[model samples]
Target chain A: MDIFDGIATGFATAATAQNLLYVFIGVLIGTVIGVLPGLGPSATIALLLPLTYTLEPATAVIMLAGIYYGSMYGGTITSVLLRLPGEAASVVTSIDGYEMARQGRAGAALGISAVGSFIGGMVAVVGLMLLAPTLADIAVGVGPPEFVALAVLGLLLVTYLGTRHPFKSLAMAGIGLLLATVGQDPITGATRFTFGQLSLIDGFDFVAIAMGLFGVGEILHAIEQDQAVKALTSKVRNIWPTRQDFRDSAAPIARGSVLGFLIGVLPGGGGVVSSLASYGAEKKLSRNGRHEFGKGAIEGVAGPETANNASSTSAFVPLLTLGLPSNVVLALIFGALTIQGITPGPTLIDDHPDIFWGVIASMVIGNVILLILNVPLVGVFVQLLRVRPGILGAFALLITMAGVYSINNDLNDMWVVLGFGVLGWLMKKTGFEPGPLVLAFVLGPILEGSFRQSMLLSDGSLGIFVQRPVAGVVFGLIAVFLVWSTVMALRGRLTSGAEMIEHAAADEAELEALRSPAAPEQDRADADGGGDARATTRTTTRSRHEEED
Target chain B: MSQHAYRFGALAILALGAAAALGAVQLGLGGLSAPGSGLWPFITALVIIFCGLVLIVEDTPDDYETWTRRSGKVGIAFVALGVFIPVLQLLGIILAAFLLLTFWIRFLSREPWRLTLVLAVAGSVGLYLVFGQFLEVPFPVGIIGRQTGLEFGL
Candidate 1:
């Protein structure tokens, strides 16, 4: 395991001023975009992808990878303060963070999320440094059925990630999967849902759809609710967590890091699930039945934020090792690699040690830079929120259009972005998620091509999916989750009437608990006042605000 | 009066998607007699349509009172998007895109128009430099062509 040799060699390449500078800049930009409401890493990468075209493939890969993790951490800032989630992965932060805000613990919540993210990320990176070779060795053995089942499970996990209501989350994911099918067919190389337009030939450009859904859609949502969680609240106090806060978060952070790393190593899972799952696990592990969950549980914020960063870092393993991409950002990074004519797989280590190790070294450097930048630069990012949504949205729209056009010198791609932008906005409001859509889009071709290739190898038998024991196990896990989700859904309908009031209140209350202090509460209270004016209100209100839907 | 028109809308969309997928498969890909590229397209569409149907049929939504409270901007945005497509060649990709984005930002939001215009222009310029000049990929160029790359000091 020449770990020292690998690290030393990686340093020689990654330490170059140009590569280092790009990695730092990429991490910085990624964090800034992640802090903002709209642009998460996928859009951030798409926006930056064109700029990197001139750089060495290794440098480009390193920078893009830096952005992915940087954004993962950056999202926590908004999730903690604004009670407005910056990215889908950061949504869990708002669950406890906003609650902590309402409880006047926003500072502690923010501090915990940051510290936890740092710990989780560092731990995961170290894990990757130690474990990637072995994992990659195993990953090389996975075949097509494994990927297909993994994709299905990945999308399903994301679909069920909704905190307010599981059903809505599943539906959103289903819609995302459907959207993925909008592009060219992998097996036949024929375009679907493109309506015969030349632009449609390639299927939906991921850039277009990503920018539309996560970027533009978020902007629209932000515009509609331009008011911040703290718009009317007092400035937060106690920026540092107390010793007690550390005591509470210590276990959860460690648990989250390990849990997140494991989940992230899986085919479909990534930071979002790891973070969310960690939070739930943390809550369950707590002895207090701590009402702090929606009311400012520092552990809640810290655990999930850490898990998110850790998972983002671990995602690189499969991507670099097996040529597997669980999410869109990795897919884009893969796209960058393919553009440069380099294939990412187990042999990559031997073929391009400079690139692989350089990327690894750069990841460490990028995380260090982010930890330094995330807190001190908090003011600058928050100020971005002050940039009128109109201005930001307009600029984002323009950048998307021109960027797509300039890339291919094609008007068709621009039109595709605009079209997806419209769909993105609608999906946002309608409870459809853009995450699964992206996964589906990126993997559809890979899945189909691999399936056909495997069939040809096996002479068209169903045995291909179960040929390898490891692949069989992975598919079996997916089957369990599918059945579990199905049972949960059916049970939900059966028990619906009993928990109606309780179910509805969880979301509203979580919003209330996560509030900065004065704003959302007054508005929410006023909205709910009409219903409460008559009967004994506290009990009904309490029931309405259950922790889970 | 629940605002969950999404439940019904989802089903309708699923049907349409499935039909399209089915139709595309029949159209075949590059050649009529061969396996054709269209086969995969149709299958993908079928996958989506099937999943959509499963989701819609499985989950019965609540009422629509909440849906009405929304500003109703989604439909308007859709209309604007439909119009933005053909308008591209007329104004050139850059100019048309700039206009569409600026209009969307200005009208869709409550902020001042100047900021929106500035954002649109700067964003377009950044894209021009990054994608066009820096990356050396080209766009339709509109009135300026690749010559615009020089003006940006690229």
Candidate 2:
């Protein structure tokens, strides 16, 4: 059927009482998690993935999608009030948002951000409605060789765009591919790495690994750090923006929507890049130069906020049409879908029309819910930041352990969670990006199966990858990226050799300071302790500073 | 993470790769046209070994840091989780969860003993009711629950 009719069906399905309730709960949970420092969307979604097993596939997807975008809105509350960015995507927002709050225009800043987010999200959903079907239609004709190229390129882009240390990321990806080789092989049905364990014959459970890596691992890290969070005591009033504020933000919202949507479609380009780009664009595009850009310009808040929401919405494009998740959050969603026995690809639109359209339609409803939740319920969400991490961490651990075992009633799965949890914690401690590893783990089998199929089809000809026109272009792009990254890495090492040493030394000093017995109390006495804590966390974790580099 | 740790990690990874490669060889690497299951694993193992070698060569002294008392806390937490597996199999999920929460809350985080007991009981029992009774997850009752006839209705 046509796009409009499919969306209409989706709307009809999503409007059901149960689906709407799930949407509300999803966004509500999303906002709470986003408001709390150190709990990101990936961890929250991975933690909650097993709970969706009992629900219908479409409902599960709709709820998970809500959590993803709902976070975009929820992240703004902390950035504005406390200047403590709740997630990486909101780091840019904290600069101008906190400035606005300091000038007692916090209400106006939040109001404008909410409106901009709604507009950007709506526009991107409209783009999704128009573009997904066409892309999926074209993708239906893609062959095994082309798929091999696409998957490889996707893996490369995920590493290159998502991380600073491409070699490390590449290594993680290799490990992920090797991990996927466990259990029975799909092509030959031979057990490769189960180690005579009957439970692992089917392979490592994705939900278990995800819960371990993101949920349990994150909780352990947070407990180890025990970050000191200071609550903001600002009173929010007059959430409605003035006419002047609306006029200032109108052009920025429109520009950010378009720019963010386009950027979101690119691999490794999502909320973080789009928001930073939007801020830069607005700073450059400011006419007459009346408003100071850094010192609380409404455009600074409006542009990036709009762009992040728009980018988050449009990130669904690749996953829905090409079956490739360009970012970590999308990668988790990809896993969620796979667990439901639904493989996302070009034929997803035809094979699971309800799921494809329902999720798109849910985004529209989710944005509205987020806008409302951000405005009136901002106070409640801010209170969520006050809940002690110890309490939250305990419950989170319990839920993760229990939820993983419930997936297949296998106790072995719980062991996997614990094992990966330790691995994940170490990865975090040592400055490795788990995003590429997780993404590669999800995409590895697809890449392997397609590569083998293409080789067989071409009778062992390695040239088969470049023989097809589409595949050839993709491989060409991969080659270009590989060369570019290698040159960049080498040049970076040469030119910034001293700077690298200094950065490493600075990191060492910071760790020493953290280890000092009296440091925590002294830090709590500092006026900007929350911001400093957030900054230290960001610097220590490479994933959090992706926007800066 | 220190330079020594990096070297150790790299060596461990190299050992793993070597083992995997040996296993893959036994599985038989068929020709490219009709590839065996070992081909992909063997190739990936080589990549992993290459990464490990690079890491060993690239190790820098700047990466080293002295271990602190806080790291001991992290180790304690890890040990608590490790101990939880047998506890879960022996005492049932409800009681095991209670003990785990109590230890993490009271000892690791050093919260008030009163609040620890309250939350540990509430959190464990609440989770048991939700997952066991409400969601119908088959949580094992273990020997204690079985002998005492204290069924959780699973």
Docking class of 2: medium
lDDT score at residue B53, model 2, on the 0-100 scale: 79
* Pairs in clash, predicted candidate 2: none
- Residues B104-153, candidate 2, lDDT per residue (tens digit)? 88887678999999999998899988899888998877787889898772
On a 0 to 100 scale, what is the lDDT of residue A282 in model 1? Answer: 77
Q: What 10-residue stretch in candidate 1 chain A is worst by lDDT?
A: A526-535
| Model 1 alpha-carbon miss at residue A475, Å | 2.8
Candidates' chain A TM-scores:
0.79, 0.89
Candidate 1 lDDT over A1-549, as tens digits, reads 377788888888999999999899888877777665435566567665545656898899989888778777776776666555555566567667866876788778777777787888888888887888776667667676666666566555444432223444444444444455565666554456677677566555556666665555544544443322234242456767899889888888999889888877765557656765787787767647444566567777888888888888887887778776766667678767866778787777778888878898888788778777765666667666555544554566555555566666676666666666666555544544454565555566666566556556666665766766766776777778668767876776422211221222245665444333322111111100011000111112223333222
